[model samples]
Target: MGFQLTADGFAKTIDALKEHYLIYAPVLKKGTGRFTDTDIVRYDFVNEASEIELERKSDYAFKEFLTPLSETLLFFTEDQVKAADIPDKPVLIFLRSCDLHAVRRQDDMYLNNGWTPDWFFKRRRDLVKFVLIGCKKSYQNCFCVSMGSNRSEDGYVFSVETDGDGFACDVPDTGFVPFFAAGQAADIKPSYVTKNDFEVRVPDQVPGAILKHALWDEYSSRCIGCGRCNYVCPTCTCYTMQDIFYHENGKVGERRRVAAACMVDGFTNVAGGGEYRKSQGERMRYRVLHKISDHKKRFGENMCIGCGRCDDACPEYISYSNILNKVTDAVENLGKEVQ
Candidate 1:
């Protein structure tokens, strides 16, 4: 088991982790309108307390470190084939509990379910470290409490907090962290949530003749075809490929992976000029059901960590909770009628 780290001890853990791994935390970028107010991952440099934003979750998630927006699966020339040189460096990412749950769900799909989890994620999983910070209070649209993901635990290599004077540190593992000034550990009084606290009432049997429910139609209408929900979600894994030819040297070009979304209009389009989910409503239904219904049937739990990012990122103001809970209740009512 990992040791309990106080605020200062946690900082020392970060310093130690950075020695071998590339440390990435949320960094704010400013510029033109198109690029302004975005979170970009960068080398961990400053240990300044001012730069830490543990009070609120980052606008972007840490999944990008493992599954990048653009990735070259395999490159090919005229005849012979060779793997592209994507860095396999282990990357240490600072994340909240909701984000950590998202990672667990992703691992169920990619590694256990065979999407082939990236070494960047796996290596980091083995060697990378975590510096978890407990949320003192809830942030905007944060439904972590509702989803039972509001707290941190010993899974982290280090944990931190602020008291009146300085900080406290714990190295549960076997390492030294020096990022924080040493002080007495504060007694944490964080809130906790349980599995049965606020469940979505997933059916014991789903996607087994219940796929064509009317709830799909209603949920689809509120969808504006925006992909913001996917962007903010930690477990929504969809991506598209891109190939750009340099004007100067067309012979040397790399294929990249760009993030894809189910809500996007053309998301389901394929080679035969056929669209898998042509209608906006169909796309929305696909995403929500995939999270709560389909994913649960295969895996033990719903893929959604219930971060409420879908509700937060929606331009059309669609609430995933309202839609999913309504569907569950509707299905229950339908079952009673059948009986």
Candidate 2:
């Protein structure tokens, strides 16, 4: 069923949910960008619905709420150790369709990859519920439609869309019925993007021979290795763990997991000072192949969600979309020669 909520009613409903759930949504943080002269869009805990930013795509994804930029895994002392405590409250997250798909990818890596589930990720995943924020138009760099991540029915508890003077929300899950009782019932359908300014068509098969191909060298000078691409991507899950020691007692403190980017220095470093990818071109090759072929070969889907945040976050303006097109052409030519 669906319901119509006035702006005020929507705020009240979110306030009500605050009693049971910690709400995380994309928010506008004014004067926080690089120059401190522009507004930045990032996920933040919201107490009321008014705090949510629905008009724009966040510069980063909602993954921070789950994986977090940095989080304590455990606390340790000379003789004793304790696991980090999980919050008692549940979590409610608002995300768009592409980001919701990104969550599934993270779940596949953290929860389903190993014999046992990741307790840290699972603990938060189990307590969280998703609310889809309707997308009516495509953003500047977004290619979600091209990646077939424009809509999803199973991940969200409900969806919210703006209509004239009120919000039209559809509650597919019966458990969410209680939340919309205060609003007027209406027949509303969720909005999704049917078209985008950009499109990416990955080849049906990408040969492993492309690994040795020199196509990626174009990025050697263009890429500054700032690592912004992975930082803004919703599906980039690589992380580095750290242990912080107390000043008074070197053996006491906490171990933490901090997000890591493959493009950054020391990512491929080894014990003997050897690095797997010494050049920026090689690093770029590994990243592109992993997103377009390697990950899909194992997971049956591309790791790149086509959210286009990588393109937007690039200081050198490297486009993952363009790289895919080049790879597609190379793979097709390689196929022809073999045949």
| TM-score of every candidate | 0.78, 0.97
Give the alpha carbon lDDT tens digit for every residue of 216-298 in model 1: 77655677787888987889877777876544555555566688998888888889898898777678778877887778878
Instruction: List pairs with backbone clashes in candidate 2.
Output: none
Please give the lDDT score at residue 130 for candidate 1: 64
Cα lDDT listed for each candidate: 0.63, 0.87
Determine the backbone clash count of candidate 2.
0
Question: On residues 224-286, what C-alpha lDDT tens digit does candidate 2 reach at each position?
Answer: 888999888888889998999986768999999999988888899889988888778888998
- lDDT for 27 in candidate 2 is 96
Model number with the top TM-score: 2
Q: How accurate is candidate 2 locally (lDDT)?
A: 0.87
